[model samples]
Target chain A: MGHVDHNTAREQLETIRTLMDRASTYRRALAPAMTAVGLIGTLAGLAAPFVIRDNARSFAFYWLAVGLAGACTAFLLMRRQAFAAGEPFWTPPARRVASALMPALFAGTAVVGPLVNIHQEGAMIAVALPPLWLVLYGCSVHSAGFFMPRGMRLFGWGFVIAGLLSALAAANPHQIEPSIRMAHTVMTATFGGGHLAYGLYLHWTEKKPTA
Target chain B: MNPEPFPHLDRVIHEKARLAIISSLSATPSLTYTDLRNLLVMTDGNLTSHLRILQEAGLVALSKSTGETRPQTTYTLTDIGRNAFTQYLGHLEQIVAQFRKTTPSA
Candidate 1:
């Protein structure tokens, strides 16, 4: 037998080990759950102008409903996927993802109280809300994406860009109504549309006979 | 010039299959028997033999759960196994580093 170079052998072993570890992680199954979140966001965005119709309180409640539903969907779907894969929901990779996600989400949640307080005091904080939420959410997803597939990072960047644009458009005092509509539209496109696209991509690319 | 002194490599982990198993187990929290077999692309008999050897050596732990319709067997690296693998890699790196220091470039 040919003698194996210790360095080359070590490198090969490391590569194999990394590939095996990645394969063992839960990736593909998250697609459907993300898609569900996106769909709910899209529906909320479409209904916002009609249902809330310039009532900031209703708008806040509408989005809160959507957020709660999306969170539930994500949790249930992820748990199901983990169970189906015969892996624990609290695996090392899952914990890493949550660790990356939680900080940004918590920061966003902290901002919500102050934003709502400002809105109740009748300052036009509504215009700033969506963009801030989107940016933070994007950051959360982007960081968590490090533990997931390579393509997920792009979605995070997409949200950040969408958020910045939303902020810029809301800068005009006379354009508050338009900006609200635009924000909802952007939320629908990024969260709802982005998730559906990601899910579909995963389904097509990652579908294979499980070992 | 004389070749550098070789580092001691753990023979138990020197085998490719066992090394692969240990490396995989070290990375993940735990792996089912089927998952490990598929990852290594080893036959049932071959994998079982290797796993048995590692178990006997106190390097691996096998847990069987009977909650499912069929009992599920999962494997995890024992602390001893983890230390052994770390030590083995350290030795391999030292050997490589020494070889590079002594050998002339092509």
Candidate 2:
């Protein structure tokens, strides 16, 4: 058997600790996924008002479809990246991220049905859906931030703050009237513009692993 | 006097490269060959030899999948490997604690 000294043992433990941290770190390149989602969101937001008009039900369905599309696009991009890196798409860390994001995202989608059904009487509630969606989406991202890179939490906070501010503006009678168009505008500013800004930032700041 | 913890350590995982590999695998579900190489900054031959040693000891499992262009291989620690790592950590902590006991604080 190989003899080990105390100094050697301590050094080995420290090395193990570092290797563990590096192995668990999230290394996936997010720029592509973020940019793709950003483009989709911006385009969807711009086209929403023209296509859906004043019908609250149509508005709800349109945004839901857009959200679904954005999510699918991100998923596909991530899968492609995993393959390119010679890694599996559904690793344990990936599972952890999905688990974290699922609850808030599910709530955001589930509430849409009831909110649209009551749209005839509680039109304000329907108008408020954009902020609600923003908060829920922010919370989802924030929860999933544990398994992601550092900036994700801040990005999540941006959505949360935007949602709260939109809610405040809606509540102020002196502010612009709460309408479906107003909702679309809010969504456009926060989801569309926010994603684009963050995506661009990531593209610029992303560090390439050296050869 | 404490019995030497050195003899108790898992020899297969006690070497520098093999220990690093085990440590990395323990942290995540699995890693691809390229991923491990990049993370450890190790050469192909060195990594392959260490991985083979672990695989032979049943401390690691390897899987190969046919991709569009080529075959991709991923490696994960076996249950025995995880258990050994946990025990190794416990023994290391005991050694550290024993050292602290012998050497009084300044």
Candidate 3:
């Protein structure tokens, strides 16, 4: 038993608070991944019209494939970063990020099935997919943002708002025609352009990783 | 001087390094040895010693896995540890309250 003073107790309490925050905080080395994803997205957007043309199903599959590729690229980049840092790839925070992302991404993929089935409104469906996917992707990112940097949450919200605005534009035939090309443009602008801009911003602001 | 003025304070968790270890573990589900070391900026010998002490006291648990490169060690707070920490926090709050009660207004 020792004589503990009020000041000592308060200092210990502060130590606990600080340590808890340090332990839980996750710093994601996101610049490279975002840049790579942005490049992939931008390229995919450019190629979509030429490759897929007006076939609604083809358009859907093409973008899905692009999304998958982008996701795989991001995962590999992150894994590489973890390796460089001499840390495990699947840490607690990584698990938390994955868990948070799963539901919304799952919903986005699931919705594509029913959407592609509507044959009569094929053009409308094609146009609709981008916005729906955007919102869902936004939601997934936003959910995962809890375990990531604060900027990530803002990025997620950007996706969500873009999706909503895209949806609104799609609904109004006067504002923008509902076509596969238009859909491609929208995806290109948001997924492609948005990621590139953010990637550039991160590159400028974030500390460069040591070689 | 009063003997054991703060009776509820956990001596095992009272040390600076040990308290820091416990607090870090309390926030997350688990942390690797490297992660904990990096967060606390403690030497390998110091962290190993403190972790050993906490483990002996049934306040922490460790796991080892053979990863791609080497054997990685991870640590987490035990049920006893979590309960102890919660009680420790309650005691600290009480101490602060007691101090406020005795002191006159500024």
Which candidate wins on lDDT?
3
Q: Could you give candidate 3's per-residue lDDT for residues B1-106 as a string of tens digits?
A: 2334488688999788999999999999888898788778899999999999999999999998776665778898999999999998887766766676678461
Docking class of 2: medium
> Which candidate's DockQ is highest?
2
The CAPRI category of model 1 is acceptable
lDDT, candidate 3, equals: 0.85
Question: Taking the candidates in order, what DockQ does each have?
Answer: 0.33, 0.50, 0.41
- For each candidate in turn, the interface RMSD (Å) is 4.0, 2.7, 3.2
Restricted to chain B, the TM-score per model reads 0.88, 0.92, 0.91
Alpha-carbon local distance difference test for all models: 0.74, 0.83, 0.85
Candidate 1 chain A: worst-modelled 10 consecutive residues by lDDT: A1-10
Stretches off by above 4 angstroms in model 1 are A1-6, A9-13, A16-28, A84-87, A120-124, A171-177, A207-211, B1-7, B37-49, B68-70, B103-106
Per-model TM-score on C-alpha atoms = 0.82, 0.81, 0.77
TM-score-superior candidate, 2 or 3: 2
Which prediction has the highest TM-score against the true structure? Answer: 1
Ranking by lDDT: 3, 2, 1
Local accuracy of candidate 3 as per-residue lDDT tens digits, A1-211: 3567767777778888877866776665789999999999999999887777587888888888998999999999999887765567887788888999999999988888777887634789888899999999999999888788778889999999999999999999997778988989998999999998999999999755431
- Candidate 3 clash pair list: none
